[model samples]
Target chain A: MLTKRIIPCLDIKDGRTVKGVNFADLRDAGDPIELGARYASQGADELVYLDITATQQDRRTFSALVREIARHLDIPFTVGGGISSINDVAPLLEAGADKVSINSAAVRNPQLIDELAREFGSQMVVLAIDARKSGNQWQVFTNGGTQPTEKKLFSWAKEGQERGAGEILFTSMDHDGMKQGFAIDPIQKLSRLLNIPVIASGGAGRQEDFLSVFKLGEADAALAAGIFHFGQLSLPTLKQYLSKNGVIVR
Target chain B: MKTVIIKYQGGNVQSVAFALERLGASATVTDDADTIRTADRVIFPGVGEAGSTMKYLRERKLDQLIPSLEQPVLGICLGMQLMCRFSEENNTRCMGIFDVDVVKFPAKPLKVPHMGWNSLHNTKDWIGDSLDGKFAYFVHSFFAPLNPCTVAEVTYGRPFSAALRTNNFFAVQFHPEKSGDSGMRILKAFLDQSA
Candidate 1:
């Protein structure tokens, strides 16, 4: 009876939630705590907080923001972006993040995934991959998709899972922001390939797109930013749509 | 009521503390036997390997202290697994509170880490029928099978004990703190028992 998850992502910059989050109720809409609480109230399965702020001072601010969000919301949230070392993960988790997603760091040193999974549990480590398709094969990209590595998407995913990653957050760089739909072929491939739950990220435009990702893509979860951020889509409405379509959603 | 979260080396203590805080209760994370014994309620929270965790507990004499305590006790995830008589995880022996064996999920078709939101049905009335069919978050590879101590059952590959109750001891394999409103209700209900 495991239900598919629907997650709304919040990108944080300068201690303020930037990017696609466009909430009108809170006078200070930048406050991630309010946004997270609203999403939980509307029945979001989980929330993802991506800290894009880079700097020693800003990382501290992001950690503090994570504490605020964890304190305010009852649902589980994963913290990602700019997480590099063991030190970076400890504070966010201590501040009450259920899981920490490592992207570029994991790509840089695959050992970091093992180390974090050892320090915390495998269930606490999420390996986030930003992949771009190249000539019949999808390549792993790092540094926010600016740098492409020689590592193939499937191999790196298998490696991450073998290294004790509890879950895989696979985001297709080519389909990202395009709103065309999720990278179904790659997602379905990964879903069939890996035992861990695959969270399909990037390019989720409408409610039906989530259905496609869940039914066709076979993704355990579907994450979106713009559509949910701009109030174009709501978690309740999307979940209801999926439920009506014979998909079990919670 | 005095509440104390039994602290071992490995566990997600902060989130559990925050969950209680939201329910208007404050708790201290401590390993001191006296603190645990004195508290009106004790929550043993964990997320780690079985053999090593049991070793840590025995080294600190918590293995002896935990079972001896006379108060309402609730175990979460690994905590609940450790309270069982035995665990297939590292072949570690556990406290005999639940009289069950924690075994790993079967390979193939069913994932090892049965991680996600799953609802509990066929629940005993002790935890109430309110949580019946309500989704509770779960993230664990090993599970305690359906037994006499089981208060509620959940189906992944098959029916497993999602929540168990015996005397004053209440335990759940799910993380209520991260399970939204339905999870909060479960926590609140446990608190009501102590009250």
Candidate 2:
């Protein structure tokens, strides 16, 4: 049986991890590769690095960072952010990033998904949709959640599935950074609506949150940043908690 | 050891090369038949569609050369699928190194692609039960149903071949390179002990 994944997402800026992590053993917390390898060693099923830096030089640095991470960490990892073009993807993948997620650029050019799925297999293309609840409907947001798009959550996700995205990493803007719980409703529906795995992100305050997301929300994977970064919740502990509660975790 | 990874139109080829590098064994990624045949061990690694990959292999004459080689050859993911007799993926006809045929997973109850980590059970020859009960990363929609060549088993909807071994040919559906320490051990054992 396929086990649910616990992923620690790191925000990268100019080749360094942007978030302030509080792991005592980590010599350099800002280093993505070190942090990533640390997580992998600690039993993290996978890791995601969101390259927030938009500079051309940063892209080069990010690519190098990805290669270093790949060389060191044996677990699967996905690299995203500022990845807008088909040209931008190959370098990261060649650098040994397992998968690349696209947000704004994919929404701006929907064909990008089709092209990426065509060029690379659908397995490597992750469609990350940032959305917030608006008047009883989940509206898609792009440009780091500052700009709203004309796409709805369910429809756009179905569209992404049709366009050959292997997985859907849906981050709930409404519940983001609130540390309450994951947006279980939409995620449960997303898992049912599409054949691909649905990764529930945001609103992960506690290990119990992961259990709910994997059980109630039916998420194939759960992704979080702040809680894991600040050492509020460790991956091994979280996995133990989830496993104790009957949620299959890797 | 002159280890060579067969290079064709495939992704994850670089990853296998990197994994070998980490194991302190540098492998050459090449399409040259002479290099592949001359190598002590050949790693046939790939991630791609079966029909297209097979087409590329045939075009490059790798289709003919791969099976004919006597050296210990290992196939990973799509490379393993392509080693079979046939594939449901785009109705692809594959190199018949393994007698089994690949079929898509049942699309109900559980998700396709059987993504993420799962334990390997019911082991046999070559690797034997040494890796039994250990977790390995798997990602695939199609699977080669249990056959005589199956050395390891993984159950999703039903039991399927996690690793298969026949003569000098060994193949795995899981990405041992991406399965962390347990995975590295498999690769190390393959390099050190496989004859």
Q: Which predicted model would earn the best DockQ?
A: 1
Clashing pairs in 2: B113-B140
Please report, in order, the local distance difference test score of every candidate based on alpha carbons: 0.88, 0.88
RMSD of each: 2.7, 2.8
lDDT of 2 at A142: 92
Identify the CAPRI category of the predicted complex in candidate 2: medium
True contacts kept of each: 0.76, 0.59
lDDT of 2: 0.88
Clashing pairs in model 1?
A: none
Badly placed stretches (over 4 Å) of model 1 are A20-29
Per-candidate DockQ versus the true complex? 0.80, 0.72
